[model samples]
Target: MDMINGYLEALPEEERTPDPLYRERLDVCETCSRLQNGLCAVCGCFVLYRAGKTSSECPCGLW
Candidate 1:
């Protein structure tokens, strides 16, 4: 899984946005990951692209 994680890690931070609707969209993706944004919204694992530490990171691949 390191390849997958690394691929995610190398993404640019600008790719992430703090839109409130993104959170709601995250919830929806939990059931089905159909979002074209290419983020793991259910687990918020995409936060790694933002290039900083967040509370959500510890439990996911962000570490």
Candidate 2:
């Protein structure tokens, strides 16, 4: 997806997850079919961005 067309709703700084946790989640998303580039087709959020959110969930339940 284009930068302007991607999910712009970012999690507040306080709600973002720690680097390690995000990295772990990203590992899973990377191998998932629902993941495209860094974006999640199910949630329309970048895998890095979405994985960084403590509250964000993987629609495919892989994360």
Candidate 3:
């Protein structure tokens, strides 16, 4: 459910990051203590979708 919501909330395609960058961001999110399940414990955002958006960023300053 969170994954679907994340994708739905992602920035428009024109503003999204490349696949590689998105994955890199996901990797960073996966290792963070703030990530809970598929969401960010800090902001309660879906890491997958959030990471895919070039306009978005880690609230923790990891990215």
Clashing pairs in 1: none
**Whole-model lDDT for model 3 versus the true structure?**
0.80
Give the top-scoring candidate (TM-score): 3
- Tens digits of per-residue lDDT for model 2 on 1-63? 355223323545677877788778978987888777677888787776667678888887776
Kindly report which residue stretches of model 3 are placed more than 4 angstroms away from their true locations once superposed.
1-11
**lDDT (10s digit) by residue, model 1, range 1-63:** 465457645655554434464454445444453333645554554533322322233233322
lDDT for model 1, please: 0.42
Tens-digit per-residue lDDT, 1-63, candidate 3: 665646746657777878888788988988888988889988788887777778888998998
Per-candidate TM vs. native?
0.28, 0.69, 0.78
RMSD in angstroms, all models?
11.1, 4.1, 2.7
Candidate-wise lDDT, in order? 0.42, 0.72, 0.80
Off by over 4 Å in 1: 1-3, 17-23, 32-63
Worst 10 residues of 1 by lDDT: 49-58
By TM-score rank, best first, the candidates go: 3, 2, 1
For candidate 2, which ten residues in a row score worst on lDDT? Answer: 1-10
The TM-score between candidate 2 and the true structure equals 0.69
